[model samples]
Target: MNLIKRLAGLLAVAASCSAVAAPLLSEGFNDVAALPADGWAFINNSSPPGSTGWFQGNPAFFAAADGPAGSYVAANFNNAAFGGAVSNWLLTPELLLVNGESLNFSLRLLGEGLLDRVEVYVSSAGASTNVGADFSLLAAFESPAGTGWLDRRLALSGLAAPASGRYAFRYVVDDTSLNGNYVGIDSVSVNAIPEPGTVALVFLGALALVAPRRLRQSRGLWLLAGGLAAGTAAAQAGPDGLMRFPHVQVVSQPAAPAAPGPGGFMAYKDPVTGQLTGPNPEQAALLTAAARAPTPLLRQTPPAPRPAHGGISLMLDERQARYAVVRKAPDGSVHESCEPAPGGLK
Candidate 1:
C-alpha cells in the first residue's frame, strides 16, 4: 500500500510539472529600461493629451511582485488634465499568435482609489501604432478592489489567429482628477497549455493488434483439453495438440457370459484419481469381460439389440451390450449402431 501511494504521488508531481508550458513571452518590469529594450510602447491618445504617461513604480503605494519597490510599471490619470478624458495605452511588442495561448499578470490600484476602469485589447495581426484601425477590445474591468495586488488570467485563443498581433492595456477615466487613480502592472506572462496522457490509448490500441494471436492459442488449448479428458494415447502438449487430425480409437472388451458386471469400466489407464476400477470385488463374483467402459471412453448412444444373422458379432467404441448391439447380416456384412446409453451419456 505504501509503495502504491508513493508511485501515485510521483505521477502526480510529474503531471503538475509537465502542465507548466514554457512561456512564449514573459516580462517583469524590474526597471524602466525594460520598456524600450523590449520594444514596448507608451501611447497617450487622451483628448488634448496631458503631461504624464507611463512611469516608474513607487513603493509608497505598493511593492513590486518580485524585486524592490520601484521595479514595476505604472499609469495614472495625469495623462489628461482634471475633468478631461484619460486614454493611456501600454502596448506590448508584436508576437506571433498561433492560437491557444494564455497570459497572466498581477495588478493593483495605487494611491487614493476610484472606480477606475482598465481595458485590454488585441490588434488584427501587426498593427504597430494604429490603435484606431486594427485593435479590438478583449476584456475590461474596474481596478482591483483592495490595496493588495490582484492576479488576472486571460485566454487569447478565441481572439487570436495564426498571425502576428499585439496586446495593449488601456487605462481610461472620464474625469481625470475625480474618478481616476494609479494602476501598476507587474509579472506578465504568456504561455501555451501542455498536452499529455496518451499511454492508455496506446495500450488499448496494442490489444487490438493481438486479438488474432489469442484466438489461435485458444483453439490449440481446446484440442489439448479434449485429448486429456479422453485418456487416449494421442496426448501431447503442443500448439496443435492431439486433434491435429481425426483418427479412429479402439477400446477392447473381454468376451464373457456370466452375470455381467454392473460397473462401467475399461482396461485403459484411468486418470490420476483411479476411477476406472471394476464392478466385482475380491470376495464377490468375478466381473464379465463385456462390462461397459468408463464414461470418458464412450463415443455414442445405445440402440435396441438385434439377433446376429449368421452367429457373428462385433463391438464399436466403448458401448457394451447394455448401451449398443452389434451383429453380422446373412450376406456376411457387419453392422453396428447405438442409441442413448443406459442412464445417460455420462
Candidate 2:
C-alpha cells in the first residue's frame, strides 16, 4: 500500500493501540524573536557581512500559508542595502534524525524580475556554525520561479541521519542590492515516521478474519515506548506510575519488602522507606505483584540504570494477582476470573 493508506491505517489502529510516529520538530515562525529561545540559530556570512538578517514577513507581499502575514519568516537584500555579496543563513534547532524522515516547508520569492535565490541545506555537524566546513545543499530555487507560495518536501529516505544535524535556509546572491530581493518561509516541519515497507507489513499483519468488534479490539502489532509488542508491552512514565499495556490490565498489587542490596542499591524496594520501588512505577508494580505470588519468585534485585533503548522484561498479567475481579451476584453467587480478549489485540 501507499504511504497515505498505510499511515491512515496506522493512525486508526493507534487510536487505541500505542503510537510511535510523530513530528520530531515543527516551526511555524509565528514568533520570530522567540527563535533564539527555542534554539534556532541565525548567522550572517555575507562577505564583509550585511547589517540585516531574517526578519518578519511583509504583509504587503503576501499572507502566510496558514496564518497572518507576520506568522511567516522572511529575508531580504537589506543585508547589503548599499550593495555587497550576501550569504545569510537561518537554521532550525538541533535534531536527532534517522532514516525514513522528511523535511517539509513552504517557500515564496518576491521581486518577479529581479535576481532571487533561496537554498535549503543540511549540516551533519550538530552545532557547528562554520558554514564552509559541514553544509550540503539539499534543494535550491533560483530566479524566474513561480510567484505564489511553493510547497516542498525533501526526504531523507536515502542518506542515513548522523548522530546530530540541522536543516538550514540559506539566502544568497552575488550582489545583494542588485540580485537579491525578498523571500518568505513558513509551515516548516520535520516528521519522524516508520519506513513505508515496515508500516505496510504491520498493516497487512494486522488483518484477521474475525468479528467486527473483535477485529477492532485486536491488533497484531502494538507499540510502546521505544519498542513494539503484540502479546505484551513495555511501560512508560505516567502520573500514577502504572504500566498500561495493550490486551492486559493490572487491577490490584502488593508492595514488596525493601532493603539494601549489593553495591548499596535497594533490592526491589526503596531502602529509605522499605516501600516498593522500581526503575519506574510500572516495574515497581510488577515487582510487587511477583512478590505476592504463591510460589517463591526469582531473587528480586534493584534494576540497574538503563541506557537509552534499554528495556526491562517485567509485566504482571494474571488472574490471581492483577486481572481477576471477584463479583457477588444479586442472586447470592460469586465469580472471579480473567477476561479473555480476542487474539490479545487491545
Q: Put down candidate 1 lDDT per residue, 1-346, tens digits, no spaces.
A: 3533443444344434323555878888887666866878888888668888888888877788777787888877787887888778888888766444666777665535464656677775574777765676655546424445667666665432367778888776766756677888888877764322232233223334432345654454334333332332232222311112125343324322221112222232235777543221111112221221245766677764656542224443465423345667899997876555454443
Identify the candidate with maximal lDDT.
2
Looking at model 1, residue 150 earns an lDDT score of 64
Off by over 4 Å in 2: 1-21, 160-162, 195-346
The residue ranges of model 1 lying beyond 4 angstroms of the native Cα positions read 1-18, 111-113, 143-147, 159-161, 194-346
Best by TM-score: 2
Task: Write down the worst ten-residue block by lDDT for model 2.
Answer: 257-266
- Candidate 1, residue 173: CA error in Å? 0.8
TM-score of 1: 0.49
